[model samples]
Target chain A: MKSHVFRPLLVVIGLVVIVLIARFFYVPSDFGSHEKGYMYGWHRKGNEDEWKAFKVKYQFNNEYCKDCHSDKYETLARSPHAVINCENCHGPAMEHPSDPAKLKIDKSREQCLRCHYPLPYPTSGRANIRGVDPEKHNPGVECSMCHNPHKPNLRGMK
Target chain B: MITRRDLLKKFVKTATGVMIPLAAFEIIDPKKLFADKPFKTDEAKVRWVFLVDTYKCVGCGLCVKACKTENEIPYDANVTRTWVERYVVTKNGNIYADTPKGARDGFTTNRIDLGMGKKQDIKKEDIKKAFFVPKLCNQCDNPSCVQVCPVGATYQAPDGVVLVDRKWCIGCGYCIMACPYGVRFFHPKYHVAEKCNFCYHRINKGMKTACVGACPFGARMIGNIKDPGDPVTKILMTERVGVLKEEYGTKPQVYYIGLDKEVR
Candidate 1:
């Protein structure tokens, strides 16, 4: 190799070696521990605990209630309230399986009013809430008195 | 014409000049320089789908409020990551679409007190039909937002959630304009492109999106479509679901059931 060209080539090789050594020292040994691909190395921080902790604040899904309340679960499945999850009204049932009394079953008039309350929203709107003016319809009467939440069609009226 | 001593001094000066910057850069650590970490989850292993049951949405605005609070969106800004539109079609074929405060505050049609003049006059007898449709980032399979991002800051994760790397985003607003659904917005405080990421930080941890969680009615749902046993797959297979702007070919992950013919 020519002397001038050889010297420049040697310098370039030496620089690359230095860079590699520097990288070895700088980069964390476990930097890509959770990485699935090379294109992106930074994975979102947090183990499974982050999501698990967040979910506990919300009501558990209907499937969890089905394990014990299989009869009520089956009945609700075929009823108009089938779309409603068990925990939506009963609250989160996470502790119910372990301690049966932990489930707070709310059978209040205010609970039914959440969806069925009188509002000016269009009937064709999503949810199509058939708004009922409580004062005129049934004053001081609980919703469950007239219509069963499980089967809202008033099956027992006959 | 330069002397040998002069040549050596010149070479040494240049060498020092190059070495100083190199040493400084090396110590700074290039690996830590990355703006954000890539998604660690295996893409093919997860197929996320968002199901919007328009027939079930009550227009209560709880989802919108939940999203704003969870994401810490600016309260005063008009921009929204998600919103609801109440479409009222008059009997005379006149259509009026309005979203009061992006539905962050629940809607009320009683215009007498709200000072919405003449809307009350045309209402009771002239209205044909009305409904509420919630809107959010579609998380398109072929997202234009991702395509227009000059920095590659907006990208689709392997699990198919479209995400924005705030650290990497340049706030160019290209992604905001590129979106067909008008989901992207420049956050007032952060000065970055912002939109619904399907609550990725929460979903990554196996929790539902904040909006979905806040919905009192079963109006919103999320599931892995790739799983045959997933309810989303079964619903998609069974329901007469529709996507927004199918002609755009974005293949939006959000599927709407009971979407009216007039809804865009």
Candidate 2:
């Protein structure tokens, strides 16, 4: 082979070897194509653990609150509001009865009206919820002042 | 001492000797070649599906707020994991749609933006019909985001949920551009690609997604599509459900019971 051709060929081979060595050292051992086939895309298996470790802010189950506030839990469980989660109105219980001690409870008129405002949409299942026109029904007073959230039914109210 | 023809014949013979054994090894046990390195197996038996009953959504925006809080997304950030859009169609067939603050705040005004700094107050009598439709990441069966991700940072999990590895993402923004649904966004703080993962942390613990738990109206639900007895599966089988952008062929898993033609 000619010296010019041989020299360029050696340089190219050296470059290829360097890249291969770099890739071997740089890529994580756990990285690969996963799930069903290569169509799913490549990812590091260890990264899934990072996502799984994430702590959700909202506590879906009411059992956690039951440990601390059994009376309120019992009252809420039997009421019409049984389907509602405690955290839905109260802010996220990520750190409760300890760090912040108590979760912030929303008592604003807008909070009650979020579910109780009379919307004209008939097709929506929200029509089944007992709603009142906020303007007509004691405008300034909060709903909690006249009613109880734990026992939402008027008949159950003291 | 070797002539050109003899040299060529020797090369061919040596090549055939090498090729035959390699071909036989592939034919006999192809997996054995790659089996030396251990790979993670997806043993999950569940296939998750999301159901949205548009008829049941009153657009209170609790789901949006819940998603934001649960995911730690900034309330003031323009990006949202989920949002509700209000669509109002006039009697004359003109359509107007708007999402104010990603519907984090409930729809307060009756006015609709006509675009380019123009707003029109829609009267009750002039409107033919109006409805709210919630939008989120479809978590498609064949996600274009996964396909376009140069670093393979975005992928679909075993439960049919598409996820992004924030650490692995190079912030190329290719996946954001490839997504037809426009669900992907750059994280405000991290500057990497971000989107909804259906609250994977909660679901794996046998709890509902944050948005689903926040909905007081039973408008949003999640169930396993693989289980024959699952409510979502039954509804998908028996009901007239629709997905957004069927023409895109992404095979979106989010099913809507009352999907309207006006919805994009």
> Which structure among the candidates has the greatest TM-score?
2
Please report how far candidate 1 places residue B189 from its true position, in Å: 1.9
Write candidate 1's Cα lDDT for A1-158 as tens digits.
55998999979976976776676665444333133232322323232223234333333366666777798888887886686666556655445656546766667655665456544545544445676766677878877777767777667342
Residue pairs that clash (backbone atoms under 3 angstroms), model 1:
A42-B37, A42-B38
Off by over 4 Å in 1: A1-158, B1-43, B111-121
Query: Once superposed on the true structure, which residue ranges of model 2 sit more than 4 Å away at CA?
Result: A1-9, A74-82, A116-118, A126-147, A151-158, B1-44, B113-118
lDDT value for model 1? 0.69
TM-score, each model?
A: 0.62, 0.82
Weakest ten-residue segment in model 2 chain A by summed lDDT: A118-127
In the range B1-264, model 1's lDDT, one tens digit per residue, is 999998997997688556554432544345753433344344477868899887678777767766776677887687788998777678889766777778776564433222254344345667677667889998887787877767556666667777776666788899889899989889989898898878776777677887787676778899888888888889999878999998898889899987876787
Query: Model 2 reaches what TM-score against the true structure?
Result: 0.82
